[model samples]
Target: MVNLNAVLLISFLLFSIGVIGVLIRRNALVILMCVELMLNAANLNFIAFARHSGSVSGQAFALLLMGFAAAEVAVGLALVVALYRKRDTVQVDDINLLKG
Candidate 1:
């Protein structure tokens, strides 16, 4: 059997990479992809715990989170598209309409 610690370590690594990408990247699309990566990392944890515990709650929660992630992606992409259309650029630093 694969060790739980190993699974958790991998998940942590994935999440950390996502966080670093989100913090350091300037492109909106890249940030969005990082956010998705983070969400998947969370899902991996949920599944790992569910497998370890032999219960379905964690899996159920993971499913719910997946749905939420999907909706978030849809809405986030729509907003990015709108922002690009308005500003002609997807750089996080350049499109600051909420600066006030």
Candidate 2:
């Protein structure tokens, strides 16, 4: 039998790790990666709930989230590239344009 509780626990742990990374990391790349991790953790929960409750809604929502994540990644990476070209670093603290 599949252990739903274990899966939920693991998902929660992954999400928490992502949260910590976003909170503590200074590199923009690491922060983006953490955001991706968070999205994946949410996806895991969606799949888990779908399996446990036998509902298609969770799966559908998960698919939507995936699509949004992909778009966000594309836009975010583009912005990162632009910032790197202008500032030559991916550190969040160094790229201060509106620091007036």
Best lDDT among the predictions, by candidate number: 1
Scanning candidate 1 in windows of ten residues, the lowest lDDT window is 91-100
Cα shift from native, residue 20, model 2 (Å): 1.1
Each prediction's TM-score versus the true structure: 0.94, 0.91
Per-prediction tally of clashes: 0, 0
Q: Output candidate 1 Cα RMSD.
A: 1.1
Q: Which candidate is the best by TM-score?
A: 1
Model 2 bad stretches (over 4 Å): none
Clashing pairs in 1: none
lDDT of 1 by residue, 1-100 (tens): 8899999999999999999999999999999999999999999999999999999999999999999999999999999999989999999999777996
Off by over 4 Å in 1: none
* lDDT (tens digit, per residue) of candidate 2 on 33-95: 999999999999999999999989999999999999999999999999999999999999887
Error of 2 at 86 (Å): 1.5
